[model samples]
Structure formats: C-alpha cells, structure tokens
Target: MAAQGLSGFYGSVFRRSITVQVLIRTRDHRVLLLRNGNAWELPGGVVKGGEDPRSAARRVARATLDPGSDVGRVLVLDYVQGSQRQGQAQGQGQGDSIAFLFDGGVLSTSVSAFTGAGGEREARFVPLMDWSGGTDEGHGRRWGAAVEALELGTVVELVNGEPASAGPVPAPLPRRMMPPLEGFSGILGH
Candidate 1:
C-alpha cells in the first residue's frame, strides 16, 4: 500500500503535509490571487518538516504576496488526504494535509512597506461577486471549488465578539500534484 512505501522511505513516516491559503482583501473588497504559471491559486505551499502551519502560511504569503507582512488569524483548516504525487489511488499518498486558510487585510501603510521577490508579477485582486463568472481555464476543478466556495461566502467569516458561521462545508476534491522540489527553495529557509 501507499502507506507502506511512505513509511519504508521515511522510516516510519506519516503523511502530515501542510498547505496554506491566503485570502487577501483589497481596498475595494477584492481578493488577491496568483497565477501559478498556468493555474490561478492562492499563494501557498507545503510546510517543511517540524515547521508550524502558521509559519508556513506566512512564508508562502511572503513568497507569493507581500514579504515582511504579518498574516492574520487562521480562518479554516481544510483537511485532505493524499500526496501531490500522481498514479496514487484516492486516500493513498505520503501524508495527510491540512490546508490552513488565512485572512489578510490590506495594510493602511503602503505597498513599499511590504516587499519581496515575485512582487513584479502583479497579483490579481478580483471582486468576490464576479469570481463565479470567470473561467477556470488553467486552474481546473479543484481550484474552481475553492473559488466557488469563496464566492459563495462559504469559506470565511467575520471574527467579531460572537462566533462566526461555519460557512460552507468543503466537499471532497481531487488532490493535485505538489510543486517540484526546486519550487520550494527557501520555503524552509534552511
């Protein structure tokens, strides 16, 4: 089985991967997204060994969005089974993954205050209401579901004094291949 292979390879290893989802709200109530070469996805990546999910989220946000900026609270923990590898059956892979979703607000300061690599790409801040109308040409269905959930107002909630709505329960979505190892350079920062 897949578990057997993973354990054998990593010496009793378990599937415990971490991914992050950043929801950046712009001044106009739009959400920021990155075109990951071909597909449009929230700026995120897998967490390294022994790294906290929150730190991983921040690292991803910095790499894809604004570095040196603080990330807000974690909004949700979307769990999914499997690894980024292909040919593995459902529920089979190296580890389990918890997709940590965070909500970020535009800084009242200035863009210059937050800078990092990949900043020149110009991240897209799309209106939430109009997201559903857009085509998911390169993103495929999984990304489509994430986008739909956000547009439906089912992914996040306002954190006031009272408890927030659970929003929409995430449905089962197919796992996509993880980015290559080189793409994760500096993700762990040694």
Candidate 2:
C-alpha cells in the first residue's frame, strides 16, 4: 500500500545517526582530549532524537567538562559512511552518520579537574601540533579541519573526514568607501 511504502521511506531517512563533537581548547593552543578505550576523542556524544544540535553540544560539554562551559558556532559538518568492523562475521547495517563539530570555547590552563562522562576516562589537553599522533586518525583530521575553520571564522563541510570540495579560496573583501555627510561634522566640532 502507498502508506506502507511512505512509512518505509520515512524509517530509512530517520535511521541516519547524528553525532555532535565539541572542540575545546586552552589559551596555550592545547586541545582537550578524552580517553575512550584506546583512542582519544572530543567531549561529545550522539544527539538525541528531535534535539537541537547546539543544545546537544552544550549538554555534552557540560556533562564531560565544566558545567559552566559555553558552546559556540559550528565549525565543521562531516558526513561519514559506516564501515563494518574487521573480522566481524555479521553485517550490522550501520547506516551513514552526520557529525557536527561545535566550538566549546577556550579554557584556562589552571583548570584541570576534569571528570569524563559516558565511556570516556581521564581528560587532558594536547598541543595542536601533536593531535594526530595521539588520537584516532579520523578524529584528528576532523580536529585539524575544525581548527582551521574556527580560526578563519568559517564553516567547512567534509565527507569521510575529507573536504567535500576543493573550491578556490575566497579573496579578502575591499574596504567600503562611504561618502562624507553633507552637514554633519566630526564629534569634536570639526
């Protein structure tokens, strides 16, 4: 029936997972990394159904890091295809996942009393230069891209941890030329 077909289509659309990641840094350029099993990851988790991503990000940050932490604009949007685990006999249909990287703002170096949430262990700050060496490769690349986007005040889109497009870099804008007021003078009565 038509209703059955429509329900199936809706179910498929809703199966995609949505995850949120927060990029919190220190003033010394060190990034926060939480130990998840053998891999280091950002402080974030799956976004609940019908939850706003920004709110989810804030919630994750509050749960994982300081409760008073602030969440900023999105830095990266990544679409990743789910892959089967090696040596797993069963094919668990892990559908595609969409991830959002949000700015968790900078933290002070003196603040180190961190208690992780979920499956995470201790949390530490690692220098930006050594992120890839200590964390999951995919997450490392995402961190790098997110950092660049944050610094440039832009948002980047990625597919499978890589830039979706290699578009040309935009040129800097020229200064606006405003005409002088006909009657108004300087505040100093010039």
Model 2 alpha-carbon drift over 4 Å, by segment: 1-11, 83-91, 111-120, 133-135, 168-190
Residues 1-190, model 2: lDDT tens digits: 9999998677657767899999988888888888777877888899997898899999999887677877999999998775522233443455568899999998778654465555446888878777783445666668888988987889988888888889745789986465567675655559
Regions of model 1 farther than 4 Å from truth: 1-15, 83-88, 91-94, 107-122, 133-190
Give the TM-scores of the predictions, in the order they appear.
0.55, 0.73
Angstrom error at residue 134, model 1: 8.3
lDDT of each: 0.56, 0.79
- Model 1 lDDT-worst window of ten: 156-165
Give the alpha carbon lDDT tens digit for every residue of 71-165 in model 1: 77665555544443345675465665556676654633223223235465545666656554234432223344444445565443322111134
- lDDT at residue 4 of model 1 (Cα atoms): 83
TM-score winner = 2
